[model samples]
Target chain A: MARHIYSCPLRWSDMDAFGHVNNVVFLRYLEEARIDFMFRLAPGDGSPSFSGGSVVARHEIDYVRPLVHRHAPVTVESWVTKIGAASLTIAYEIKDPDQVYVRASTVVVPYNLAEERPRRISAEEKLFLQEFLAEEPAAV
Target chain B: MARHIYSCPLRWSDMDAFGHVNNVVFLRYLEEARIDFMFRLAPGDGSPSFSGGSVVARHEIDYVRPLVHRHAPVTVESWVTKIGAASLTIAYEIKDPDQVYVRASTVVVPYNLAEERPRRISAEEKLFLQEFLAEEPAAV
Candidate 1:
């Protein structure tokens, strides 16, 4: 399965007083990458018109190394790990070609905002996600 | 053991497009509460001058319910779940008078900024932390 790669720009303010990217900011980067993967790319590939209208049920993140703000961008590699009947798990790595700064996973549940409740994954959405499905990540 | 209670003020910008407090913002609240627990209160107990010169090694956060913007502040209750030689775990709950919004835990490793290395829990620091230690939280 193929992984979605997002070239994430780093904001200078992302770094805290410690001169490194704050742990909470790393989750923002993951959200950006996940949005790019699920919202931007998925529907563009001739799948359903559904976007990333979902809720983050849970998140597990590991900060492998500290990241300092730099001019160049870091790459966030994301792929589907588990797709359940109503939810899906995505794993990601924010890294450079040489080193990984963070490894993380998020559980997402599709929601029907108009109805004010979560909805099950549709057949077409599952098929779209299947293309990027990798049950086991190499490292993350 | 006493749990650290922090009244976290919610910013209007903390909400995402969904009009609820974003999941990432919950982590920021946790950070605020942790700083209060580890930095503001720890050394002030007449223990050593060791503050929260620590790094977040890992975080596991579960969003139990959605919260919208409000004038009143939410409460973050933090407690020690495990204290190891080099690291400790902090479990927290972001709640209000009647409901819990999030349940999370973080593994933190104390670091020596000048020496640039992880350090073991000192005797004084351990004693200070022990006062707040509760191995098993009611439902973190």
Candidate 2:
């Protein structure tokens, strides 16, 4: 029931012509945070099933406030909102202490890359993810 | 009401390490199709208010099938899903003749870039957008 925190560094190219981080680039940040939480921090000794192969089935993101490029890193907090047999939903907030730039969620499905098919969540993997389980507001 | 169709070309870089288009890149395709429908094809011969300024408030996208990099362009169909006083929703599909790769929707709020706030839709803009009005399935 704890959240995963990632300090995501901002890239100069993340900004768009508007001089603010482009809405699409926010997904890249979420991808990075998710990779850290699932691949690096999972309980497995090495090569978690998630690292083997996974697919993004869906994404819902809301832009709260515009952000400009800065040298400092921003905080991305993530937690599991839902876990089904074949898919899981991870929710995230990209923010500072006082303000939030984005609220988002992704539905991810485990896949057997070699077999090219979706797979059920492994017990070991589920146990690792269960530690971060929490509910999020309804996804958009 | 007609759908705005864009022949969206794929870049080699659009594919991820998985050998399929990165899920996030699909948003860029939707952005392109929306820009064509609103900024280029809107009735106004001159720059439309959309070009002046607008913001993406929210996005919901679902992946239907994986698409590999191809020389031929894919088709992106877009239409207005909802238009409120201060916000509008656009629905899109990235597809070929027989298959759909993604389905998505975006809620956009017109903005006064200088004033830094949302603005109401104009009568002329509403009239033009009405021709493509469509209600999509629930956004995930």
Candidate 3:
């Protein structure tokens, strides 16, 4: 299971009144990481092709600790937790260099553009995601 | 109980590759509405003065529909849902002028800045919130 590490710089506007990165801002960071991971595996252009698109079904987030404003960049680690016939579960860990900040999991379903409904996962996508899942129970 | 309607312009960057406001972006919009609601009720100068503060505990969101890109403004309708001993639940409806976009609910826990933990709701604050919750739910 190889992990995909996506890094992003925190913008000034991302901070809230408490001087910590706003909780909602983490969702944007996570989306960027997920998009990057998908492009890495499939190697698509910037636009998301809809021939077979993906949509989020649900998201479960646990903010273990608040991320404070920092000079250094933050890393978002993501991987497929479970791949089903028509859906997949992706998990994320957001952290600075030393400490883990937030953890989240999202359920994504593959949609067939033609049918306008969810479709089964392709063998190719399953193979690609296989490289990222852990052998035992996945963490973070 | 009068409903406070807060309108926010959607930035071009708020849209994702799907040509709609990203799922995560909705959370930020909700936060803005929540903050604005708090400020309107309490009428405080913008500062980190949390001698009496609040934090979000749990959020249950429903993506009933999607809001597409448009030049028109998006309206966020927010109101108190329920007031508890130490927590307050707020409901939000994000919509365009004529149609519903999304529905969301959040639980916010009041905190004492001095104690640095959750605290019981004050009589004055509870009365204010009760008035807001007494109104009918938003259309969106």
Candidate 4:
């Protein structure tokens, strides 16, 4: 099981009046990490990329504790939880060096650009994601 | 009931690789609208002005559709859903004027800054919120 950890700087706007990182901002952090992971592993330049499709899906997030905005950086850990025939479940945990801040999971379904609808996960994508899919709690 | 409709500009950073506003970004929009509403109604100097001590308890958002990043502005419609002894539910709808984009709801609980725990909703706050909470839904 391979895990990708991406770190991002906390901008001043990320904080709320409580002097804590606004809850919604966590999603943006997760998105950046996930996109970086995909680009690194897949490595393609196109609308749908080498997989011949795009991905879209839903997400669920649970806030574990408040994160204070500080000069310190935040790290996001992302991994594929499950890989379905046409969709994949990815799980994420955002934390500082000491404690966890939030846990989130998303379901991404492959989309066919030509048909403009969801398509089956390609063999190449499955192979590429195999390293991530093999480890820990299976995808839901 | 006084309903506030806020139109916010979409920043380039708000769009993901999919060319749509990332799902997580929607939450920030909601926060901005909530803060603005609070300040407009309460009339404060905008220094983390929720002196009443309120925190978000739960949030549920439905992605009715995707919002593309165009030059057009996005509108966020917000109103009080229900007010309880210690909690209040605020509902929101994000649209592009041409169509419905997303619907979200959040439950906020009053907190005791001194006690470090949630407290009962104040009578004054409830009374102030009543006028905005009693209105029926708009004809979308």
lDDT of each: 0.88, 0.90, 0.73, 0.73
Top candidate when judged by DockQ against the true structure: 1
Superposed model 2: Cα runs more than 4 Å off: A45-48, A138-140, B45-48, B138-140
- Best first by lDDT, ranked: 2, 1, 3, 4
| Tens-place lDDT digits, model 2, residues B61-126 | 999999999999999999898999999999998999999899999999988788888999999999
Greater DockQ among 1 and 3 belongs to 1
lDDT of 1 by residue, B23-140 (tens): 9999999999988888888864333334636899999999999999999999999888899999999999899989999999999998887788888888777888888788765654
By summed lDDT, which 10 consecutive residues of candidate 3 chain B come out lowest? B43-52
lDDT of 2 at A17: 85
On TM-score, the leading prediction is 2
TM-score of chain B of 3: 0.84
- Among incorrect, acceptable, medium and high, the docking class of model 1 is high
Docking class of 4: acceptable
User: What digit string (tens of lDDT, one per residue) describes model 4 on residues B5-101?
Assistant: 8887788888876677877888878877887776566433233334546676556666777777878778999888898877887888888667878
In model 1, pairs of residues that clash are none
Q: What is the per-residue lDDT of model 4 for residues A1-140, given as tens digits with 9 covering 90 to 100?
A: 88778887889988877777777788778767876776556645353543455554666666767777788788998888899898887788888778888777777777766777778776767877777764544332
Off by over 4 Å in 1: A44-52, A138-140, B44-52, B138-140
- Top model by lDDT, which number? 2
Writing each residue's lDDT as its tens digit, candidate 2 over A19-110 gives 89999999999999998987788655355488778899999999999999999999999999998999999999999999999999999998
- lDDT score of residue A48 within candidate 4: 57
In candidate 2, how many Å is residue A50 off?
0.3
Off by over 4 Å in 3: A1-3, A42-53, A96-99, A111-119, A130-140, B1-4, B42-53, B57-60, B96-99, B111-119, B132-140
